[model samples]
Target: MNAPAPPPAPRPAKPLFPEEPAERHTLSVTVDNEAGVLGRIVGLFSARGYNIESLTVADVSPDHAVSRITIVTTGPRRVIDQIHAQLERLVPVHSVTDLTEAGPHVERELALVKVAGTGEKRVEALRLADIFRARPVDTTTSSFIFEVSGSTSKVDQFIALMREVGLVEVARTGVAAMARGKDPA
Candidate 1:
């Protein structure tokens, strides 16, 4: 007689809540140009333990009645969605757009990088800056302050290269992002 086959191995159970990978997000928030608006917005992030990687604010309206805030943060998808929802509920906020999810967008940042050196280091710094298209906005006998503007990543790479040559100080303007198409973000 043939032996009975053993019971098939049981399949592994799936997790109740699957872990979602964290991702970087760029958010554009339009709001009334009023006092304390920025403070309140920043408070929300602080209360929730969320970190703001980069932030830039400006009055985007010709009438100066409206302002735009661009923020870069990192978190899970769920958290990011919750943040968007919460921001919309605030009284000052007019609209909250997730640029990262809104399709093609343009992001740019300006950086002032100062390099101090003499001899070969100075020559190398100027050479690298020329390659990166960074113009010398201020130049002295010993140092040069170069202004570079581009995507955040490009600015970062330029700063890194400057550090190798003779980077001394750096000032960044955070990030300004906008949707690529006709739609406003």
Candidate 2:
């Protein structure tokens, strides 16, 4: 009978636990600028065991009634979708947009990096900062506080390089993201 139908066609076995690589997603949440609102939003993430890579909040409305919160996190696609849904259910949240999935977006971060070194290290640090278009906001004999702003990866690279030269401290403003084109994110 056709060679026993080739042993009934072996079937591929599915793994018991499917592994999905975590994906980074930048979410823009619009909420009322009121007391405890930010706390509640932040609490949700903590309660769910979700980690926030970057978070930035600013009042956007002219009257300071509305605020825009940019939160960057990494998780599986299903987890991201769940986060979106939960954010939408918040009472003060006006809207939640996944800028990463929405298409082309621009994300930038500002970092105040402090490097301490002498001689060639100092010169090298300055040279690297100049190459990255970072300006020296403050300078002293042994250290310099640089104001660097650019894409997240660029800032990270600059900081890593500075570490080799003598990175003392770093203050990052987190990520501020916006969708491309004319539409508001």
Candidate 3:
């Protein structure tokens, strides 16, 4: 019993890939504009332990027969491909396009910002909103609701500045995206 034959050495952990960075992806999915379609798609992501950073869905086709669902997510490349494959298999999904890799797409979000203040603070808020190209949608003596639409970064910066002036609340529509070319996504 030479010290219990010296216990076997602990094995080093081996990763599938040594240094694969997690990447953010924007996916555009076309599906039938029918009831329960969104729920099913969301369920698939949840069941697989994947998170949806931002999602927006709306009817796109004039007849209201089709809807486009834009989803922003983060994962390794392999995972993103898997998401695409799985989405294609869904009964309601007609197409799943990875817009992030599809080249030349525009992404935007709309936010309604409400700030409460009077006097100089209120004036500052309005001035800052104008700088951001945001318009006052609703206003009163004490508060104002400004409508801002732009890239996610622009909206975020404007909101941060508004906080100093008197940010009371924020309501944002999740990212909406579309390919740049004349062809559909």
| CA error at residue 11 for candidate 3, angstroms | 4.4
Residue pairs in clash, model 2? none
Candidate 2 residues 113-141, lDDT tens each?
99999999999999999999999999999
Backbone clashes in each candidate structure, one number apiece? 0, 0, 0
CA lDDT for candidate 2: 0.94
- As a whole number from 0 to 100, the lDDT of residue 99 in candidate 1 is 94
The C-alpha lDDT values of all candidates are: 0.93, 0.94, 0.93
lDDT of 2 at 169: 98
Local accuracy of candidate 3 as per-residue lDDT tens digits, 1-185: 44657778999989665577789899999999999999999999999867799999999998999999999999888888889999999998999999999999999999999999999999999999999999999989999999999988899999999999999999999899999989987
Ranking by TM-score: 3, 2, 1
lDDT of 2 at 178: 96
For each of the candidates, the C-alpha root-mean-square deviation to the true structure, in angstroms, is 6.6, 5.8, 3.4
Estimate the TM-score of every prediction. Answer: 0.89, 0.90, 0.90
Q: Can you tell me which runs of candidate 2 are displaced by over 4 Å?
A: 1-17
Superposing every Cα of model 2 onto the true structure, what RMSD results?
5.8
Measured with C-alpha atoms, the lDDT of residue 25 in candidate 2 is 98
